[model samples]
Target: MSVIIRKSLLELIFSGAFMKRWNDKLRPMELVEVDKQGHKMIVAWLLFLLNSKGMDVARKRALGESIIEGGIYDYLYRLIITDIKPPVFYRIKENPDDYRTLSNWVLDQLKPRIMPLGEGFMRGMSEYLMQPEDKGLARRILNAAHLYASYSEFKLLKSINTMDHELTEIEDSFVSRLEALRDLKGVSELLNENDNVLGRFARMCGRLRYQKRWSQTPRVPETSVLGHMFIVASYSWFFSMEVGACRARCQNNFFSGLFHDLPELLTRDIISPVKGASQEIGDLIHEYENIELERVVLTPLRDGGYAEIADRLEYFLGLEVGSEFKATINRDGEVIEASDAKLAGEYNLDTLDPKDGPLLKVSDSIAAYIEAHTALKNGISSDQLHQALYRIQQTYKEKPVIAGVQVSALLADFD
Candidate 1:
């Protein structure tokens, strides 16, 4: 593809009428005219509004303001005026209610609108949005779409009825944290309340898989992070129960599994090569992430009045503030001897001990096998399947902890 096509596509992604015109695959010059011009005009108008001072000054000014300031304000303003197109602003000054519905309709129209973006762009966007001193119009866009609300707004909107509004001193505390996550934009899109707990749990599992390894796959059928979460959560629940675990453990494991990858919402899933770089490089990335989480995740949670929610999540993960370290504990308490019929043994605390480690490990492995198997079933080469099988078997062989179990057989059974 030419640079013009690439540039036009980038411009089209942010265009209001993009969906209407997208299938045409119009000429690069036409695309440039439509998308680029529209963006520039809209951004220019916003810059004039924000920084042009009085009306007389605004009208007389011929020269444009800085694109940076204007672009930022335009993005923020668009968020506040979600669904209300630039055209509507001209007509709705007199009818707020009609404009409100029109605005909502516009956003609803975009909800089903999906876009396929590269992992590089996705991660960049996440990092860009997660800054503490951040100013993102997209987040505001999400908020205006009613995908998110302040904690108080959520409380009012949800009518959360309960005698005890605050967390009891002895309660798990994570419950409050989970409650805080209730109103985040894109979160509900990711989680499900209509589905049974197992169903909801499954969604979380799918997300974890996507977070760890999205680029390895050629294409993501449903490209949103939320969609990926839903699938993984389902598989995790199914495999967990199949392994003879009880309902509660499975649910907790499933939830933990889902949330295990939540940070990726901010970090984006860093591929293995970039992540496995030199110690200094890795540490630098880690440090950058620490800064971002504090700015993006932590502060947002606080501003949203769900500080307790963030606190609980950190506690559950056994992590402290200002650090990205997460603890994943094994299921079945301590590591047990593979041959020991009693299945009891020493507890290993010197390593990662996240609550969902074992379950996530199993879920992750099963998902890989299932994905590869599905591909083969759909006519992926036998050679490809064999390669996947080799990797799966080797992984099981190396991970002595999981080798004792029947994970490979379970995946094969599914196949």
Candidate 2:
């Protein structure tokens, strides 16, 4: 039963024309990239989670300031507009007052394309313990995330001269709208906090554009850490949905995918071969990454009263969680004892493990295969990429199933 659900969601994500736009073109950054919209959508979801944490603060501050009745909506609007492409973006910019018109128009274009998966994910999430209002909010955030994810790569292209002018204008427009809402109490503070956290994350993602993937291969467009994270998260979501993950489990998988490589933000992307050199060296690098993650990301969020956020990050990166191999599924297709079971169960699924930690591992491999396969299709010859594609193919050759879903079939679809 869960496999059927997962299969449908996976198909939906892949078949959506909106998502196809990203698949159709390589990312603008001089290197080949995969699934730009998919990546942005994942980040948008992350931002939504972060925003949810501070919603109480936001509501109190908004009421105190009395700037407008819908300050929170405005704030989200501003964050979302950053992902809108030109023409539509310019149309929105020109009318500003007609934001509703532009927003509606944009939705008209995207809702049919992406909303089914969005709604399905939400329904799957319904098994979690959240207020009805929160579920509604989550739906809205997911919708916005889906739209923004498709366009976010453009923002990263600003560093390249050819794309600088248009990207700058789009960014300027986003900034101007943000500034207009700066006067709302907590708005400025919240934006600053987001900038400190998410902004830094975004910039770190940009640096990945320059980091070459499969460096051993002949020339290939670089797959930055940022783009990789997005693909991982997107792939993870598909797997999670296939497994009939509850809202909390799905959220855990998605976020874990998004931040799995956050340590790379500080250390730069240390290639796998280097880490695989020796267990001692690999352990040392892992230790260093953990230390940096704690010092750079976790501790700061904890001090800022976002201990939950910090904990989530730790869990996603396998910092505090034990080995993922411990995760298992029951004959009934339910998670039995996942590494993150205790935490995942806190939100719901008290008797069943969420298995998100292990699921994320599978998604990570799938994303890697897609990267290599896409590169090969573009005629970039590389022994490493070809090897990677072969290794992944062989590894999952025998219908590798996880949490009751046949992941091999998912991978086979691409082949």
Candidate 3:
């Protein structure tokens, strides 16, 4: 199958917004799948940082892709197996025959919509879901991330649901599952340990759920910065696959998209309007974000013996290049900025550890368009959103292609 990103695939990614978690229990705030996936990926990254010390880039890429795909497979399966209690789901897993029968149904339902991603990707996803006994490190990392994110939500529920009969069991379940992974490099420190650097980092990432995008404008089913990051990451990976980017570039793009707005966690969601109002204002905000990002997040990680994470983050955020959206390649341990044309023509190779910054920028804009268009369709009306949708459409209207993908045409799907 040729690589393709169709409307169905995009919608499949966005459908997470409609799938609520903890629906069976009382919840203070709405817990949706997208936000949880976002949080899970962040935690997974932190875990990777912890355990992947001295790991080679190729192995790191493989681990990262596995985590990304595993999360996707879990999300798709859960979309079909909605609202099943955890114990019941675990019981179903224990019975291989029953679980296989159900998962096969899900794969069948998903086949058509997912096939456009190419046969290799479809195979990977199927293999991940069909095997009920994958206890590999990637699987463990994903499980730990899932538990960590779910525990975050459970903390909220415990505040108001003290009288609920299931509260104790739920709390015990979370503790047991997390404790099972204490042997992992960072899990022990992360378990209710606030001062640990990794713990503090993951907590800060979780706090992004409280930061809303387009904070000034009211929109239906409001989106958080955390959720938006995951959306962009997913889009970039899809586009990366379509463009035949190297394996390293694909992971780099996905993770770059994942953490591109991380500074916003410290600065809050500063809208583009304010950033673009004046060059001085933009530069000031940019400088402030970098200084704070390093002092608060990166420095602590490096000082705490996790320089790998900080280095990778700086590379992903393109700190030296001055913009995450700038195309770059590493040549013999030296970072070289490349033009979009140069990247496509001469540097689309895995050995370069390339990043398609131009393509990621496209993905970022496409995510923004989706957010605005979805809100407009959701019966919300505001001048800010209207102008935003119009602006994105107009900007892409004449640009027929980006990184070999027809991005302008992609936007037209919404119109």
Q: What is the number of backbone collisions in each predicted candidate, taken in the order shown?
A: 18, 7, 0
Name every residue pair that clashes in candidate 3.
none
**Per-residue lDDT of 1-415 in model 3, one digit per residue for the tens?**
6798987788788777777888877887888888989999988988877777778877877888888888878877877787888899999889989988988888889999889998998788878988868799899999999999989888877888878999999899999999999988889877965978878888888888888899999987788888889888999989988888878888889999999999997799998888999999999999999999999999999998878889999999999789999999999998989977777767888888888788888888988888888888999999999999887777777776877779888887776
Off by over 4 Å in 3: none
Candidate 1 lDDT tens digits, 226-326: 32332344344444434443333344344443344455655787753577668788777777766775675566555654454455345433344222222
| C-alpha RMSD by candidate, in order | 21.7, 8.8, 1.5
- Identify the superior model by lDDT, candidate 1 or candidate 2: 2
Report the backbone clash tally of model 3: 0
Model 1 Cα RMSD, 1 decimal:
21.7
TM-score preference between candidates 1 and 2, better one: 2
Clashes of 2: 7
Order the numbered candidates by TM-score, best leading.
3, 2, 1
Ranking by lDDT: 3, 2, 1
lDDT of 1: 0.37
TM-score of each: 0.39, 0.63, 0.96
